[model samples]
Target: MLSPFDAHIDAELAQAVATIAHLRRALEETSTPGEAEEVLDLFEKLLRDLERVKPTVIGRTRQHGASWDAVGRSIGMNKDAARKKYNTNNVQRALARIQDGRPATPHPQRAPVHP
Candidate 1:
């Protein structure tokens, strides 16, 4: 059975795919430079949004007990590449927060240490 997180990811990816298809059709049907530019801008924004969500999705998947190999397969990468890209201290902390039943926001900055 798919987890709730998996279902959410599926829904998001489906929406993104549909939006991209619509943008592609719009781009193809554009009669004026301004319309094409608008479509391009929307596409850029969608790309940015996907980039922002990718790490969070990966972190959540890892938190749900997925292995790096599984993540890599899902994303069309190798295990080492997936680990190198998504395995960061921030991601780890976020996963920790999720496991701890807290919101997965960034931890506050620490004060400098003195010798």
Candidate 2:
């Protein structure tokens, strides 16, 4: 069965696509290479930030009740891949923090995943 988190992810992805489309339009209207380059650089930075935060986002979503299946569909993967990639030791630490009533720390962008 489909999960509600999948719907949320779909909506977010749609919004992201719309935002990128608008950015592309603005980029095409830039009159100078310098201006276009600046926009391009910012766009690339945004993508990098998104990639960096993806694992944290997925972990937090799971903490808040999203299933791996939903997360996998959201990112175009399967359940096992999603958990294998995102639910590493860092996530466990974060989850423990929440359970122990401590503020969550910023997780490293990636952690070693164990079988």
Candidate with top lDDT is 1
Which candidate number would show the highest TM-score if scored against the true structure? Answer: 1
Question: Which portions of model 2 show Cα errors greater than 4 Å?
Answer: 1-29, 90-115
Question: RMSD (Cα, Å) of candidate 1?
Answer: 11.0
Return the TM-score for each candidate structure.
0.55, 0.52
**lDDT per residue (tens digit) for residues 11-96 in model 1:** 55886888798888888889976666768766865675466457769878788899999999999999999998888676666445
Candidate 1, run of 10 with poorest lDDT: 106-115
The TM-score of predicted model 1 comes to: 0.55
Model 2 per-residue lDDT tens digits across residues 1-115: 5343344345446656765876788687899766676566557644654564465568668867998899999999999988887876866664455457564544334332333
Report the CA-based lDDT of candidate 2 relative to the real structure: 0.64
Q: Number of clashing residue pairs in every model?
A: 0, 0
